[model samples]
Target: MNPRNNRQVRLRSRPNGIPQAEHFEIAQVPVEPLAPGQVLVRNEWLSVEPAMRGWVNAVANYSEPVAIGAVMRAFAAGRIVESTMPEWPVGTAVTGMFGWQDFAAIEPAAIQRRIVDEDLPISTALGVLGINGITAHYGLLEVGHPRAGETVVVSTAAGAVGSCVGQIAKLRGCRTVGITGGETKRRMCIDRFGYDAAVDYKAPDFEQRLAEALPGGVDVYFDNTAGAISDAVLARLNVGARVVICGTASVANWDPPPLGPRVERHLLTRRARMQGFVIFDHPEHTPIALEDLAGWVRAGRLHYVEEVLEGIDSAPDAIAGLYRGENLGKRLIRLA
Candidate 1:
């Protein structure tokens, strides 16, 4: 049964630096009837990622900035409960940019992915089997291109995308070193995610530890946080190293752009290639990504973590929590 009111987390104001809990408010509005080629989806899980910081900020990203008074744009997984569209009939499980809402009356074109692996957990569609997996697959393999027996260091290594990148690097027979914030995640990198070694960036001896972790120097750097940690990694890049720019989590402001170590010298001396990865730009790799990621999940070759918070009200504070490094892995709000 379709709900009458749609509860959506609406952007009340654009933030100066990072999105805060106060910037959003949940409002329940009457669900509109489905128009032709439109489907009503009951969003079961809402995702909070590092990238949402850019979406709500007053800056141009790959996508347009989230306008004030609009539903806070986000990725969510749900089921089609009602449809005027044949492609997405009632009860079809799907994932899309459905925003932070309980229900959505969206056109079929809005659906980013059609959930094919119904046997797996529905939440995977938003994470490992979704953008996270796709981004890691292409960014590392296509962009970073780690060869077997190379040293691959990943920042934010225990995060959703970073975790996947670490595992995939290992699967390619590469030596993996994970750089994360806390001691807990550092241990998780070694024990849970199968990293050869992990360094805690918050530690006082972080540079020493990172150096020890990479005695032979870095062949591939999977960068998620582009700040001080990246500078350290950049300083130690091996000749012909590849740097994949995935996310800039630690960057507070990019309007005038925060100044840091110049990357040109590093790139020139190491003869390395650094390229930014926006997952939407690599749609051709989706099928292989979904296939291999799903197969790995079933075979226990890949593992994922999800920290689920309950209900729509949890959505507002979730993005801010992500910036604070509160969640262990992919953070999703589960609707009851």
Candidate 2:
């Protein structure tokens, strides 16, 4: 393959707040010849996630920040077009951390999962059947275990992970409440995602609405945005409630961490358990989660929406759009 044919989005600078187009630079490079045991894949879909904000920031977090001038880190799904490895034959669909590039020449070890289930669109490998679904499954079921008739509140309720979490919690017989921004997304949380109640966090009476939504107090809080929204949810936690810190979408920067109401009092008063969830920690459960999620999707029990941006140039703006709440469900970039 010609080097000029390979296009990549590189991290030009560390973001101070939410990332902008100026933080990234697109470059055309020559594709390197495959090393022994390496496969060359042409990406079909690239996932744009809220966690990306942390990935590009200068501050340290669960994972190392993407170094300056490196290809932007991302989870992508594609088909192997050329291979020196016998195991990864040409045309095998795969999902992996291939960064923001059109083609990736990587060892088999870099591939996270081979995309089977030809019955579904290959892009589902980056959405419902991928990290988003897996994160929702383990985070809610294993961590925020909800019981029948219990109230389960999820922040960022209309997003990729939160939407799945709400639906899964409902399947478990729990009453679900979703907190999102704007009326459109709030309505989507109830009408599309099947949440029992939805509250607009941007409303003037958000606290009141949240209280009304969960009159019984929150039994399980799937905390995705750890800002003022979390503060309200923490205050409403019932005794022994479980709080799963999945993602921090609301907080702009974490380096000089934003100050907020102390959570010690809330946790102590409610005797609640707040745990952080990292999907990579439980790799063994991925297959189990995918099995159940795929089944639900086939049965029409699970519903998902995707906002797709065509071509690699759209990636930088897509990231900014996500922070602006411009997407309704899963946000993806279609490369092919």
Candidate 3:
């Protein structure tokens, strides 16, 4: 097979608050031929997740930050173009840690999943059926442990993981409450995702509104935004409540006068437990979670949204968008 040229997005600088276009640099790269046990893949859709911010900063305990001059790390969906490995046939659809590049050279084993059918959009594998959905599933089920007839709350309620958390809670017969940034997102949480209720954090009386929505107290708090909203959720935690520490979108930008209040008192008063999870550590449960999520989507019990940008050139801005909350659902950059 002929070698192809690819484009890749690299981290140019680290941002202090919200990342800017200047932080990313785009460059053309030459794709190498697939060696034995390796495959050459062309990325179709690239996921820009909130965890990417943690990757950029080099801080998450489990994963280090993206070093300057390196191709930005990201999970992506793509089709194999050439493969010397029997396990991954050419033209096979797959998803994994493909990073922010138009084309990549990856070992067959590193390819997490092979597509069963092309009927489902490839992007779903990256968001709902991929890491995002798995994270929501395990985090909520194992950590949050939502019980029927109890109230379940999630922050960043309109984003990918938060959206899935709310829907799953609803399916389990829990009263689901979503905390989102604006009216549009609030409406989406209730109308689109079928949350029992939603609160707009941008509203003047958000705290009171959230309280009114969850009168029985929150049984499961699947926290995606760790700031005041989490504190507010903590205050409403039911006795023996379980809090899932998923993502901290609230403090992505390390600025003076940190946002949100201390929540230790709330945790103590409610006699609740809060736990943080890294999805990678639980690879054994991935297939089960993906099968469950895929079933939900097929049955129309779950819905997903994706903000897809075309080309690797837009990857930098796409990564920056997650911090500013510019895009909805799963933010991705599509490459041909």
Candidate 4:
């Protein structure tokens, strides 16, 4: 591999609110020859997730954020261009936390999962069959256990995690409703992902519409967005309901952490359980979730969409777009 062939998106500055292009710097990095047990990968797809927001910030969440001047952290899919590792042959595909780069010199241990099923698009490994799928599966089943006929409402309803949550809930025979930004997303949620219904938060009477949509009262709330949308859903929780506090996409950019209506009253009134969990806590449960998720995909019960942007230079903007609700589904950057 030529040293000058590598390209990466580096963090130029810490973001104040939503990140802009000035915050990122695309540089053509030099890749050294691989070590005895290393591999050089040609990245094909990079997953743009809300979690990337926390990664770029200095915030100490479940993991440490990317430091200034470092390559912006991201999960990507790539093909092995050169390898000394026996397990990973050249031209083999893989998914891992390879960051915002077109070419990566990584050890075999750094490869999270090898792409084996040739029929499925390699991009799916970064989304429906990747971290997003695991997040939705574990967050819902491990946290928001949906019983048959229970209502499950997901925030960020048409996104990667939210879409997987809805499809999985529907597969479990639960009545599923999605809360998304626009009518188009809402329609996509129902028509494409098998969500029983969807509520458009951009509508004038969103709260009333949400109420009308889930009349049975939400039994399992997959709380992805944690501001007003969460407040509305919390208020409608049934007794003994379970709430999975996933990402707070709705409030990711709030500096003062925009005032949220107290939902403790609803918790007490309904005696519902609201638990916040980072999916990594249950690493052993990933395969359990993936097994079922893959089966669902094979059974035609799961549908996925990806909004792919090309090049590593586009990664920063692609990530920022997730916060702005510009992405229709799982936002990814295609490098190859």
TM-score of 3: 0.94
The sequence of per-residue lDDT tens digits that candidate 2 reaches over residues 287-321 is: 99999999999999999999899999998777889
TM-score of each: 0.98, 0.97, 0.94, 0.96
Tell me the lDDT of model 1 at 73: 89
Cα lDDT of model 4 by residue, 259-324, tens digit: 868878888989989999997688787678778878878888798999978766677687777887
Worst 10 residues of 4 by lDDT: 52-61
lDDT values, one for every candidate: 0.92, 0.92, 0.83, 0.86
lDDT of 2 at 205: 98
Which lDDT tens digits does candidate 3 get at residues 111-155?
888877466788898888888889999998888888889888889
Runs of candidate 4 with Cα error greater than 4 angstroms are: 1-4
Candidate 1 lDDT over residue span 1-336, tens digit each:
245888889999889988888999888899987788789999999888889988888877898999999998889999999999776789999899999999988898889878989889999998899899889999999999999999999999999999999999999999999999998999999998999999999999999999999999999999999999999999999999999999999988887888889999999999998999798887889998999999999999999999999988888888889889998988889998
Task: Looking at model 2, report the run of 10 residues with the lowest lDDT sum.
Answer: 1-10
At residue 237, candidate 4 shows an lDDT of: 91
Say which prediction, candidate 2 or candidate 4, comes out ahead on lDDT: 2
**Residue 189 of model 3, lDDT score:** 90
Give the TM-score (vs. native) of candidate 1.
Answer: 0.98
User: How far off is model 1, as Cα RMSD?
Assistant: 1.3
